[model samples]
Target: MEKTVCELFAGVGGFRCGLNSIKDKDFSLLSETWKTVWFNQWEPGKKNQWAYDCYVKHFGTSLDLNGDDTTNVDISIVDKNAIPNHNLLVGGFPCQDYSVARSLNGEKGIEGKKGVLWWSIWDILKIKKPPFVLLENVDRLLLSPSKQRGRDFGIILSCFYNEDYFVEWRVVNAAEYGEVQRRRRTFIFAYKKNTNFAKSLNLENNNSLISEVLEKKSFFAKCFPIEKLDVFSIRKTTISGDLADISDNFSFDFANSGIMFEGSVYTAKTYPVITKSRTIGEILESKRVAEKYFISNDKLYFTNSDSTHSDETKTELSSEAKKTWQYIKGAKRKYRTASNGHKYIYSEGAIPMVDEWDKPARTMLTSEGSFNRSTHIVRDLLNNKIRILTPKETERIQGFPDDWTATGMPEKFRYFCMGNALVVSLVSRMEKILDKIFSEE
Candidate 1:
């Protein structure tokens, strides 16, 4: 029998896709979907990929109630008896409470709903007892204020330590791995005591171990425009830099030190820093900018002390129009673009930064964070307006193949899908170490 593998919290199967190259030959059974699912009649949970038509079409519909034969099985699911014995388990667990980008709002550890998923993964590991386990998550998981963040991670370590598995972790930036994206995630690897890692586990041996894999080079060295950029343009973007150095008051254990990474050989690009506290919705142009509007009283009044539309009828109309504008603006949210090219403007809180090449991107989400469907974007050499990256662009930034997901899915669906994907170059490197571990020993 081939080595069995399983994926949890599969998220459009990014882990599955990466493992495909391995499982195709060395591995046999693959398990995904959810676990403890006793009956199909219990209904699919939100986390189950089965609700997605695209998932079924790609991975084949799951019929197994849990793991045993109902029909086919979702890679995300498991039933005690149906579960397959696997040599490896890999996945990026969900992270919301542990995410620094979100408001802590009284949450501290794995106690929150999203945070609790870690326990579930741990449970499965306890049951299946795979020889190795790989996990991915936002780097922030290392230190969260509730002390809960640190506690949870510590618990994970203790769990593995007691199970006779050795654990190793490294924070990897996608940019460093080869993709032009500034995405960063933490990789957690665990190996059973008997697994002979040999030189593969030797962090210094990455070069020697990956020579063959990197040789088949077929990626871009640098992203367009970013590779050949004028620093003057960026210099011009500064609104105001303080002359006086501000003293920082807060002290934290893990000081923020980013090591932007880029890939070697093909498919290379500079990682544009993810713009923080901004959004991609600001690229929209404003249409109405009048300093004043009309007002009315009593039976009806209109205009201001200096306006010509002070006439009673004009006043009434202006008042009505202003009110109408408010309603329309509220309904339209940020902007209203008509097919004829007319864009209706609405009131905004502050000018939010839109994602553009000329500018860095907004912060990335763990999985279902904001702007899940849009990428941070800025202008280019041309002055024309642009939209955030579609799913296809996201795939490239994540080091996924151009045809990363099967074609024909709606752009919105794909965008969200790609946003949840991992940076392949980083994870791929981690996987290479595993490959060598098994091959050598």
Candidate 2:
């Protein structure tokens, strides 16, 4: 049976591409097995809709429905039945404060402003009940909102528990597993209660749930292998209560990795298996790249106004960009005063002037093309010039094909999509696991 998928928060079809890829011998890209039935992509407060345009350009738009906005809680503008039923649901929803408080009616629970999008997903899940769900988020989601450390994640678990789903999660770093970037993200995989995988969670020793999840036979532990876990610290703990109470007092010590089954969550620390890594240089494009992409010495300034340079007003790098490499890559301590009456010391470290080709590149941010401090600068070994990474290079770092975002869209938007996307190779590995489980069924 061909598995159908619906992608929420789909950015340039990264999940779709991985799930569908079917390569021939010699590992060249070929075809796909999985099918995407419907997908939703909307950027709030934007008129251009470049992301959506690029997505539609790459994968033809779905005409099965008139409205597909998940945030429309009312569902009046859109018809629920318009969505095709599928076996899988996948997405990398935005990270936000996931606070759940008692409803004003005092009879129901509601999520925080940004967290309301979750309810949109739940709305579809209740109706469609896809057998499998795959989601991705930042590593910090494990411990969010300093005041209430694990409250957000606790609420997420409770929602799945209420729906009778068993979930396994891991914080995976692409570089650790031989990918091109050092991006770390938390991935969540869930199985409905009646499925074979969920049924197997009915273990003889619930106290050793964490160990069971880390076992060789477990799905995640197999795909992304991990070292032994300290079972005592993270086995068979329950976070139970009305959503409101859990919000007020959730555990502050949520583990980095875990599984939730039958209302109980088992969590522990897990490390990745060391593997070969690809560096920034390996993914660079030279001959095809235009000369304008190269950075000249004069273009490195932070300000266009005629003001004396200070730590606050200087460029990301100095006029002598190459000479400032050390200052850009070293740590410094400085005393400063705030705009108000407060006085304090502000100190921070610097990133490399030129990204190291021997190691994986750092995390790509939305401001990829801008002259921001976090932006990557690489030395063109061929021409002996320094320049920022082009959008195409950014795409390669995330395991996407060259010009994947090129559809008459602006260069900045292309970089933005790659910044928000996951490494496609990571999803490709998960696709194999999904196939194995489905075949067993």
Candidate 3:
């Protein structure tokens, strides 16, 4: 008594995350069929998206794509009874080329690979012709135009029209809806032309979720006004903190050394060298907090008052610890710096943190890349401890349940999957919608 849904370009189930009881669907037979077809490399430029591999890793039960054991063939290959009978279809198509962030200045049309992915979704819709379809993409898509016609979006208008569907749309921001980050995207809802329903829902409706989701927190929480917030000159500053005592050797500073964000230096006062540095190993206990690590900031402050040095026997630091510090000082001098990112858009600002400890991950990109070089470094404003977020932690950030991708896949592979996944919280609402729709059926 439930509606059937097939997610295309499904990255970690954002479209379906909100739907309860994925167990109700037999997902494996669907995966086997999908794997044989979608993952094949024969088609010209038709291969699985990198994140699709991760999607496959998290299998639904014996349930095929539709959660039905009996109806498991590809839609194009199905007969009348074998095909799923459902009132709705849902998906969030790829949006790289059509994203507002990508085209802040202007938009080129749908020639980009991400733009082309929509055609595949269209192909499925044309073949199956479900009564209703729900889809989402970046707002930039509404404005993409070709010189001949006013906009490529007109093509979408025509596509739905030809399919005998009535289309409606609204622009919504995730931050306004429920997410912490201010992410605005466009959602288009299409229904069979002339179909009867309850009270008519129109385009630009359902904007209540914004306030409903984020009421109290963002209301009184003052946004850090970028214009008014003080910006410091990019002065070349050395990593500072109470360096670990001499007896422990150079290991104390290895993960801790790095440039702190502008004002982070003084704000985080140092705990005692004896107490704080000793506590770090416990803080970094991989098992207790395998997904998090202490990242040191650039500014190192000395808390060792009247602290003696190795050169001077009166120095508080043990001779061995002083010797280790010198090695790091020597290593820092030898370290070669590298460029931040691609020449064009990267110049606007250093890359945002692609990964973080304990917190959810930053957005992922499809590019074959390493995030370590990105602006991923972090210094806890309260504690100067720091390190690059491990790949597993990145998975946690993207809302991939801890270690789901790690147990079976390579760490880099998991990182790629997390990098391409949608924020779980964003997709989680969809799961609830799917459940309500199915329950009524």
Candidate No. with top TM-score: 2
Mind giving the per-residue lDDT tens digits that candidate 1 earns over 348-368? 332233345433243354332
Candidates 1 and 2 compared by TM-score, better number: 2
What TM-score, computed on C-alpha atoms, does each candidate reach? 0.52, 0.87, 0.50
Which stretches of model 3 miss by more than 4 angstroms? 21-53, 60-85, 96-115, 145-150, 180-184, 194-199, 202-347, 350-362, 366-375, 380-384, 433-441
Across residues 240-318, which tens digit of lDDT does each residue of candidate 3 receive?
A: 1211111112111111011111111111101111111111122222543332344322211122322222122223444
lDDT of 2 by residue, 1-441 (tens): 358888888878789877866222122223457878788877766777787777777666764454454421233234556777888999897677767776787555564554356766666777788889999999888888778888888878877777777878888899988998999998988889898876665643455655865655567887888776666766456867467677887765677677777776777777777788899889887665578777766554333323222353233444564233344344444456788968675656655556877778999988886766677888775776778888888989988878888878888888888999998999998888889888866
Structural RMSD, model 2: 4.8
Best model per lDDT: 2
Model 2 lDDT, full chain set:
0.73
Instruction: Supply candidate 1's per-residue lDDT for 40.
Output: 21
The alpha-carbon lDDT assigned to residue 392 of candidate 2 equals 83
Candidate 2 residue-wise lDDT at 47: 74
